[model samples]
Target: MKNITFADAQNLKNPIFIDIRSPREYAEDHIEGAINLPLFSDQEREIIGKIYKYEGVSQAKLAGLNFLSPKLPRLVKEILAYKEKGDIVVYCWRGGLRSLVFTEILRLVDIYVYRLEGGYKSYRQEVVRFFETAKTLFPVVLYGMTGVGKTLILKKLAEKGLPVLNLEQLASHRGSVFGHLGLLPQPSQKRFESMLYDVLKELKGFPFLVEGESRKIGKLFLPKELFQRMQEAPVILLELPEEQRIKNLLRDYQVDKIDIKYFLESLQSITVYLGRAKVESLSEDLKKGRFYEFTKTLLREYYDPLYKKSTAYLRNIKKVISGNDIDELVAGISEYWGEFTGRDLK
Candidate 1:
């Protein structure tokens, strides 16, 4: 058996990551893209742990071996598939007994297996390291007022072969007061870093674009190294007309087709900015099915001010007006980015 680091395994042409932790631990948060070939199920693992603590190592080993005896054939089959193809990297919580035992099992079948030296926990430290020193990566920060379509344009840029990281999407957030309303549950911090580490590993030689965001996207804090890189990178600002922004906001908010009650509750937090009269007016519009007017009014009264406050926190931004068109917005920013950074967004 060989030992590998997260970075080394990631750089492999086609490395298969085996997550050997219990299903519960795997479910809570794990290295992104890892497949759980659990060494034990949640209940079985719990029982084994209790035995180890209360009975002794001998009893725990007996229990563990019994659990493994039945699964070994199936597990060996899976390991052989990877062995036939290429290198297989296995990891458990701490690169301790579980992974070592699994690797030994694979080796007994004459399969080459590598265990991560310190498992997922150690990989997270590297992610934190990457985030803390992101300036070296030279990421071009995508800056915009809210609802300016920065994230969508980042998607478009990525589609056109630019290296891009959609941080908010990874975090399942839109990065605003109203942004979290429609988002799915965010990944745990370990999982988030793992996902980040996996994606960044794929971009070795190219410059990448990242959304200019605060350290925290909703609840998950940006990795320290990455957040610092964003702070130092030169910015590309995107703009759009108010009417177009309202239209974009309507589609993005999903209020027309989604549960209006959720949207209503989200708006309550904006009451301070919208004032009692305007909030009542908008609330009544929701009841009356006058959403377009409601959106237009809300943009003018609430979102625009919020945008000003959010952008005030960022610096060194170069503006690219998107006019009333999303395509124009994407094109203008792409062209300028290609020219200024020498990283083609074409």
Candidate 2:
């Protein structure tokens, strides 16, 4: 019966958020760091929902109780383990039956439990609003074609404690046609925003560095405000030779390890833009394992051409940094950043 509003949940010390939603729902999205403690399995949830829709709430409640009765003892045992760790915050899709029932069970054992006031939906609103209206953030966006190790360099920057957010990593896609190769399916938009919020919260102040990205990184759209900030921020182009870029691509993409079908499908996406003849040529190269050659063509005929159009009006290319040496590139980024913010990255 205890309730903690999403806003107040932020101030709780050592809070452990327990998501009692179905597995499918939890997979779609939940509060960050939440542990999935489903009161009903995915199939069990669907059956209950159908009963509620056709039979009515009274019958639905009866069916839900049937499912909970057998699981109650184990659920309490699992919850009791978290006692004394911190305030335990339990929630369901909409602060409904599952979480409340679970909380009531725990309360009987004299264990204090708090439920999220409006469940995951309310928490999602706060996540969206935080991104849409975050404080004025200064972003220094690093720009490069498909390669030039921008993501790798972003990792280096983060390693050195620079405020850096890896959008592609958050989306679980690399932000290219081939971005999804060998990676998990892109997260739901809600899930993407939640992870993005987690990353942004860590670096709330100062000039944070983000890789140059389009409005959509795979299936996830960068929050409107953050994307706009990137477009308007200073850009440091990491220029590299076509050959070197191709080499970098091969190393990072591991094209040989990827399915030829996936690679061809990736090329298929740009057939409209690259034209059928070039697309066929690229596919042929992929089949023959001439990854380096295919990469060069992609950069020149597909990636670079599109990149040019994307940056055509971005006159804010404040500095051009290029080299195979990561240290050199890191130095270039650090120097440009200090110049823009007038503060050294300590």
Candidate 3:
């Protein structure tokens, strides 16, 4: 079997990445685009582990073989479908027996396959090191209160091929107490690191734009290497009138579109800070279809005050753009950054 490092696998043109970990492990995280071709279900893996620990390695091996023998034909059939897609890179948790078996079996049938050396663990290490040592990055941090459309602005910039990092997108969270309001559950910390590493590696020396966020986003923390750079980069304050911000926020949040029970529970979490009387009043506003009033109160009392405390320390205040909506934001960014479209950002 051809043995390759994660670096080699990454550079391989149009490679099919097959993850052969257990379903449970894959559910936690896998290579961003890799296909899950589990070698064992979670229960099977647990049983094998117990047998290996309590019985012996030899007995455990036999049990593993019994489990695999029937699945082999189906596995081969499944893998063969991807034969012409690209070169195959197979990995498990640690390039252990499961992946090795897959590599050998595929090779025996004359399909070119490479086993990832040290597997996902090794790939993860590469990710950690990339951010830890990244010094070539030029960041343009967007500073503004919530609902100022930092994330939306980044999306537009990315569409324009300007380097931009969506930390909120990577974490699959909005970096708030209610960030997960209508979104999927945030990835596990390990999974978040994997996704973060993948995106950062692709950026390579671009003066990317990003939102101003704390060290943590929901359950995930920013890699200190990257966060430190953001802390020092040029800051552009995105200021808009409060009335416009509130209007943008109501549509942006889609608070009424969320699961009512879930939304209420989320608000309940911060009631201690809001006080019981205030919380009850807001709930009544929501139940009575006073979303605008409820949202306006939420912003005035909670989001705005919380955001103002942090803006006092913004570094390298290079410029400020006051605008609302995508077109206006795009024009503001272009006006500020027009001269260096293809060159390195200052």
User: Against the true structure, whose lDDT is highest?
Assistant: 2
Q: How accurate is candidate 3 locally (lDDT)?
A: 0.82
Against the hidden reference, what TM-scores do the models get? 0.89, 0.94, 0.93
How does candidate 1 fare on TM-score? 0.89
Kindly report which residue stretches of model 3 are placed more than 4 angstroms away from their true locations once superposed: 340-346
Ranking by TM-score: 2, 3, 1
TM-score winner between 2 and 3, please give it.
2
The residue-by-residue lDDT of candidate 2 on 57-133, one tens digit each, is 99999998999889888888888888667889999988877788788878887888899998998898788888777
Between candidates 1 and 2, the one scoring higher on TM-score is 2
Model 1: per-residue Cα lDDT over 235-269, one tens digit each: 77777777777777788878778777776787787
The lDDT-based order of candidates, best leading, equals 2, 3, 1
Candidate 3 residue lDDT tens string, 254-311: 8779766666778898887889999999888888888888878988998898887786
Clash totals for all models, in order? 6, 0, 0
Q: Which scores greater on lDDT, model 1 or model 2? A: 2
Which candidate tops TM-score?
A: 2
Q: Which ten residues in a row have the lowest lDDT in candidate 2?
A: 337-346
Compared with the true structure, all predictions reach lDDT values of 0.79, 0.84, 0.82
